[model samples]
Target: MKFRRKHYTDDTLLALYKAILKPRLIEEKMLILLRQNRISKWFSGIGQEAIAVGSTMALQEDEYILPLHRNLGVFTVRNCPLHQLFAQFQGKPTGFTKGRDRSFHFGTQEHHIIGMISHLNAQLPVADGIALADMLANRNKVTLAYSGDGGTSEGDFHEALNVAAVWNLPVIFLIENNGYGLSTPNNEQYKCEYLVSRGAGYGMKAVQIDGNNVLEVYDTIVQLSAQMRENPHPVLVEALTFRMRGHEEASGTKYVPQVLLDKWSALDPVSNYEKFLLQEGILTEAVIAEIRALIKEEINVGLEKAFLDKMPEADTKQELQDMYKPFVQTAHAPANATKTEKRYIDAISDALRESMLAYPNLVLMGQDIAEYGGVFKITDGFVKQFGKERVRNTPLCESAIIGAALGLSINGYKAMVEMQFADFVSCGFNQIVNNLAKSYYRWGQHADVVIRMPTGAGTAAGPFHSQSNEAWFFHTPGLKIVYPSNPYDAKGLLNAAIEDPNPVMYFEHKSLYRSVAAAIPDSYYTVPIGKAVLTAIGEDLTIITYGMGVHWCLEILAKHPEIHADLIDLRTLLPWDKETVAASVKKTGKVLVVHEDCLTGGIGGEIAAWVAEHCFTSLDAPVMREGSLDTAVPFAPTLEQNFLPKYRIEEKIKKLLAF
Candidate 1:
């Protein structure tokens, strides 16, 4: 490898060859370790190194790259330290995830690499989000997202591509057609002649190339990336290649034809590239020997350090601290007295508007949230104030929107999403539980996004629209659940949720959106999350509730002056105010937990259990709990009224008092 110039400099060409060669050599060593049972698994990229190396090399260092699990060359070429990479694969403390996760299933901003989950296609929309941030900031940075032959068949693939093309983001979606998706042949993948044709259907520019040819991959990326930076649009590139080894050493390739393997062996990228370098007089026999020797030493050192490193501590203390991270906050002023009072929905909208003014990087994404002002007009006139770039009206792609919000969160932006109806959040459940909820625990990604959930039963919206499903997220760790029952708490909690570093599910009961009203300060203020509010004072009994449940308790107390009880409104559910609830439980010696969700799996059960365990001696009677019946919310007005806990909650309060 000597300094010289041709269509490309001899030094530059030699470096690309080494970068491409490194991962192949690493995979070869890993294969040996796998055979000996020294390592757990190996997803070999032996025959498909060129595309990873060339495509990554084409992007600027500041730009982002989301690589598939099989694309090890993308990491090596980006100068990700070999020792740390090996440690991560071996579950050592020095790994990127600090041994929290094993193998190449982790991501860090250090290498501009966003990690991939087991759900491969899920990362595509996340790529759009990173690019969306750069696009909004008017930065020339582009994102290159990789997917496999099988990933194109996933719903995320289509949704992500459509989002990118519709927004005209600077994204390069690369597909490495590596013959098989874990033993399922390409014939079973799709009907299209080539994966590149699918891009045309999305109205995106696309092309196909020989993935084996390093120069073709490199030159194509350089050309297309330059064009994208100038115009800022997305394009898809399909690279036809073959993986020499099985998907993993465990999953053998007996499913593939021997004749095909023999043919591809002849076009082995590493050996053929070395031959090309020799044929071009760019490298000598001595230099080739030096390159191989250098790689051998690096691999040996990386593996040695990884084997000697200490394993991560798995004690309760360490595990507890690893679940979430905190962020800095801005100061808040006390609310000013005003003659005008606001409704629950007004308070939420005001909180969002004020938060946007305070946090410049705050972006809002949802369906019909722009010109239509959302279904309930919570974001009315926001587009005019914040501009369409900040207030984006997204396609009805819940998975993509949520994934993009995570992408934005990691890239130094805050996003607030509206779930038209809380029930519809089921569409983006995977992204929420797997990606958003687990990002911090898996890696150190902050999910600084708020999902505004309009929930509860009313207006005959039926089972699909009126379900109160806060328990779904309550069951998942690393998420904050804030369900405000009135305007005062609504404003304060929404602001607090936006300021929180972790993912927050803000469930707003649609039935209380207009019915509930309170005199709240017109200025900015945040009610601390995880703190239950003492709404009413009494000695006879204690009532614990949130959201619409608070309204029922208050209504019953108002109708009967003799029924005095201390009402505790749990503003935040995940980090529930245990001290407040416990203290209240002890004061009254009689306790009842009420919630709008079904009784069987509702959060009310969890609260009741906690109270029973801690305040068993203080109880005057058995700890009581009440909730909606174990059934879907009904469609008819009368049936829906019967299904809700409002009517029976008063009777339950009377029963608890009588006990």
Candidate 2:
């Protein structure tokens, strides 16, 4: 039968209402707990319950719902125990998140809720990804995503909608227009009067509905969702509602005007629904009282359980110590693991080829990565071998490319996305910080992804192309950041990143792409993440570097043999190899950190801090750091060289010898 669009009838409304009200009562109790100082904080979906409940009701029991923080109502309807949610808010072990997720970012895989993400606009692309996975699995499930009106202003929002529309994915975007985002009113925040109108720009079927009216919301979603599941196309629904409270627990009624509250309070979803039910003879005043009593009981039981739950103990932490344990243990092996063989670009190509063969779910994507071999020719001829699906080429939209890559990752594909140039990554910053970095903590291992970007400054590509922006991502948590200085680490770490589960930002040095060469094994192998290599040993001082800086130091080392030095290459930054670095600094008793990124808040500062703490007692002198000056990387070779560290290993060794 062809899918028809319309609202749910009485029977469907009754089922959906029962599911939604249960969660609403829990939210109210959670708020009460916050007031009592029992829980830290919470963002309530008190006024806009229908949008979450009604929309989720349209989905199959097992279909994924990648909700924003405010959509706890959806998770409750999906059968996530109220106690587990309360415990999550309380940061207890029994919580759905296991006490890892930040408040508001909570849910569970067991409940078939993909999890709630705290990043404002991220759920849209993730929803697209869930739909893609369902489509690939040949499942009839659809993904429903709920976001606030404020989130619609984000670039990821447009990127997700565009990709979903083009691919005809099965996704339902529900925008809960909840009047205010923090303190900014909807009118002041966006030019558009209706958030749903933005969907039309992406060529999607969109509607604006009365979100406070559960009957209307249920009716609309029921009619639209069937078409989405049957044919697999994306649609949007703008739910117009009002906020009954401030943004979160920290926010009070001070910023909210009394008039708006009076107006909206009169239109509370539960009250309006009760009136509708009474008028339709579906419910009576006595039955409503009984329903409220039952809801209160449910909330009390859930709260009691949450209060008794314990936080994770030492054993649980010890058990998960190395959960994604390394397969190859070459720790005791000599530097014989290091080899001088293939060109750097060739190693990247080989890594991709080998990884593709090793993992069926690994995919390569970027502009011209297929037949064109990529602009730099790094991915030259990969499409002919891997096919267009795996080694795909995309349009010039960097945001769209990243947005789609995010979706692919959610669908259980490790997407190695290449930005034609390092500077172009700035265009997809939202995906990097808001989605990829925060996804793991938000979703509780629901999304693991990888992004491979070509970077660094030696090419005279000017200020626009040569900028080293690693600092932007280094500040973010839950993301693994890596920069390989040689072909061996490049291939090994790339393999590890693809094989492991987590979102990774892998930066390939543009200057070292073809200039460097090293030996690599044909057999599949991996270098451990968060491990640094002591490339050269000496007596004077240690030079901490990675990527192009590592190569530069090697050349400087050979020139000044008189002044002994040790070189340590930090392969990864987020979970840096502090142990290795501390040991190296202790041996040398002095340190100099180098990188292509700007001086302030760069990797150098990080290393210097580590030395000050762990290697302080061993140091003979104050640790120093060398990096590009605080300015745009100039196009002229002379200025660019000046911008970079002129104090190479030899110069540093000479200084250390004097010290």
Candidate 3:
């Protein structure tokens, strides 16, 4: 417990003691409440207070922190009022998330803390993103991220470390290795001698520290944080400790060996720290008693306020409204602006280039997107114009890049991620669905990011490269999906997606990238996200489609000009133009939904169900849906063509028209 040098004075030491002491008391109180059935759950960091307290206090106050569930000391150290913290645990309306989430799951922007998701190591890459903001702005700021020993085994752990290492982000990745991950012993968790040793593989500096030694933990982090600030690099600091309790209060610690518990019990961090404070002449018996008495009073007052606070009443309307923030276009094209015909891909490039210039906070990250451009050359010249910081070429790690985008968004930067292909997004699915999509709803942290997905099949690129996977994200809440068929809509929609304050999935059809062309405006303009375009207006039937389907239906209509139909291109999938569809369905009295995805569980099914429910009285025939057959997209041209709905779109339109 001896320190080589002391960074803090007597006053600072006393403050540190209070910071460590309060959370210890709080954990004890929470356990009592849990046993009394007053609280639903508790993850007690009983013997591990040193790791949370020392590391947090060592960092600069303005620097960001991502704390795990067990790190209750972080909130106390940050000066969060105990009453509000209790109210959060109590799920009260006055809580941080306003009762939307429970316990330490919610993040408070005021504190510069991003709370951890249950998928523990996922926040590692996010820390890199926050550091990226600091690095880009040349700020001497560092990020502190925590994960359990078990979390080190996840793919996100490796992805995050490698990303930080290669980028040289200023982040202190602290692993609170408490010997077990929900009763899974470290003996079975990793084969390596120590988690810190694994940092060598990523070319990161790493060290192991005694979790029970507050002075050692605090000094090590203080020095490490200073080093990282001076020379911007990630470090892995593993604090070896033992959890004295179960994963949760309900899960009894019967699995733990009695001998191990005895060994750790004598080395309890809170008590051990108190002894050190006494030895250092920082606290007398009377002062310690007085501090304890004051904490009890504080805890009592916090409990009173929490118990008096009213529970949040569920409001469906408000809940749905909170999912997405209103996006307003700051820039627009001239009303009578001159236009020229361009390919869909060129239009996307133009819109992106325009957005980068219009919004200095905007940044783009993807694999092979910088000097080499993208695989499709969408961002071919981005780095030359916007510089490497904004136009970043990330490693081939989808999850890390996506999570980093969320991190950048958290720090007031608008980030966009370009998935090499649509199907490849599955690698980053957890980050999109769980982290980015849930951030705003969980804690009002807006993910001002746009994920550019190159989607659809037609070029015989096979299953991995080509996919119409909007349906995967369509089912997830809190995500905006946009698909455009022509160059005009592509530019407008892409701009709108960038303008949005939430996460947007902008789907660009691979086949239509070079084929589809239209007179795109020279200036920037945003198409409203929830609005659909009527490509060809008619009264025969309501033909709903998007991406490549819009062109298919146009050709079908030209072949038989007599069979006129309302060809509606739903540019945005989520928060779709339902009013426009309902109006068209009522006008035509029949509905046909077309998509390039497989027939079963396709977006067409959802549209058809809605049409059947709302436009049943107006329909002249049952809602017909045409999609690719339920099978993998083949590599052969004919097989791939047959696998998509491109050939069947004309037949579907004609059948609905005749019906």
Candidate 4:
């Protein structure tokens, strides 16, 4: 094969040779380990090493690279230790994820590599966020995000690319078109001639290149990197390559046609590059052999040590405790108090203002968050105060907003994302549950992002607009759920959430935005996340609730003064103050949980269960719950009131007293 020379030095040619050879040898050894049952599974980059190495070669040591499962050559180029990579493959305690995850599901903050999620194209928005952060900090670093031809079909792919282009972010979208997404061919994925062409629709520069040729891949990426450094605009590059092996070691290539397989096998990237090196006189036969032998020897030694490494012992208690560590803050509250009376909405806005001023890297992103000041005016003056760079108004993309926020958070920026309404959080559920919540546990990394959700039903906003969706996140581990009942807690918690080193779903009741007001302290203070506040103390029974339900419980107590009960506001749902609830349960000897969300699968059930399990002997009556009927929230005010009326809660309280 005749190769085009693009003015590459001998050292650069040899470096590329070593880069391709290392991953090829390591992947070949991984296949042997899979056969020997030493490693669980293997996803090979056997024929696509050039794309991985070439795309990453131009990246500086401090720049970020988000690589997929098959991009083993990326780790090699990043100088990730072979023994650690082998340990991760073998599921040892010393692995990147502490052996909790396998095969490209791990990354280290120290390496500046964003670990990949199994869901394809999900990391693109995250990469955009990292680039956005770099841009905000005036850092001249570019983020390289890798995906496959099949990933282009996912909604996240388009959302990520669009945002990157619109913001002119320094992110390179490298799509390794391996002709197949698992078993499905490229034709089934899209009818477009090339994936790179789609970038035009997003207003981004696009290019297509033969990924098999190492020199071409390197030159193209180097040029793209240089362009991105100067202009900071996203560039989509479709590197045409092929998945020469099955998706995983256990997945047979029986579905693939042998002719197609043989065609790609003949154009093997490693072999073709070696031939090019030899023909160009950049490497002699002896040198090529020596490089191959050295890589194989290194792989063997790493494999032997990794195989002997111990597996991590299971510790459910420690794991759970680690997942919910207390939020640590770097900034202190102002010593002098500037007390002021403000509505819930104003309090929230003030918190955002204070936090942004306190932390220069703090960012606010959402639909209508900047110029429009959000739908509820919660961020009314953020744009003018913080400017468009920090207070960004994103497209109507809930998933990307959250995904990008996660990326920014991981890259050392504090991002507060606003989901227009709580009901819409379902759109970004995967990013929240799968990526945001699990990032810390999977890779021991913090997605220090706060998602502010305008929640609850009060103005008859119907099902989609008004929903108490805190329960959706309550069940998800590695997330902190805070539902503030008043302006004081709202401001304090929002500040705390923004400063916290984890993903927090901060729910603010839409009804209470203006209706709830108080003379909140104007000094920075974090309402303890997991602690519940005792509103009214009594002895007959205990009413535990949060959000709008807290106000309803207060209304119920005022109406029926004869029914004396301790009212406990559970501000944080996930790590609910068990001690406070149990102590109140012991004193009152009765428990009743209330909320506005549907009765079925509500956080109330979990609260009831916990009280029953922990304070069984103290309970003088059955643990009861009051919630809306198991149906969609109605649009009509009468129906909405009937659905979750104050009378219904009173009825439950009466029944608990009778018991």
Q: Judged by lDDT, which candidate is best?
A: 3
Query: What TM value does model 1 have?
Result: 0.97
- Per-residue lDDT tens digits for candidate 4, residues 1-659, read 34566787889888988998899888877777788887788898888998989877877878999999889988889888888988887778888977888988977777788878889889999999999999988888899999888898998998898889889999999999998899998889999887877988999899998888888888888888887888899999998888888988678788889998999888888888888888888899898789888888888888788878888899888677666544555545655677889999888988888889878988899888888888888778778877999999998788888899988987889889999998898988899999999988888878888999998887888989988888899889999999999998898888878878888999999889889889988877767778899999999999999988889999989998898889999988877999999999999999999988999999999889989999999989999988988889999999988887566998889889998
Sort by lDDT, top down from the best:
3, 1, 4, 2
Q: Could you tell me every candidate's TM-score relative to the true structure? A: 0.97, 0.86, 0.98, 0.98
Off by over 4 Å in 3: 1-7, 328-331
Query: Weakest 10 consecutive residues, lDDT, candidate 3?
Result: 326-335
Count of steric clashes across candidates, in order: 0, 7, 0, 0
lDDT of 1 by residue, 25-121 (tens): 8988998887788778778788999899989888898789998877898899888898999999888879988887877778878889987888878
lDDT of 2 by residue, 3-22 (tens): 11245466765576576677
> Candidate 3: how many backbone clashes?
0
- Residues 1-659 of candidate 3 have per-residue lDDT tens digits of 54433667888777778878998998888888888887788888999988889999999888999999889988998988889999999888888888888889878878888898888789998998999988887899999999899999998999999999999999899999989989899989999978989989999999999988777788899999999899999999899998999898878799999999999999888787788888889889999999999998999999998989999999999899888775565646545678888999999999999899889999999999999999999999889899999999999899999999988988879999999998999999999999999888888898998999999888889989887899999998999999988888899999989988989999999999888788878887988888898989988888898988888878888888888789999999997899999999999898889888899999999999999998889888999999998998899998987787877877777676667
Q: In terms of TM-score, how similar is model 2 to the real structure?
A: 0.86
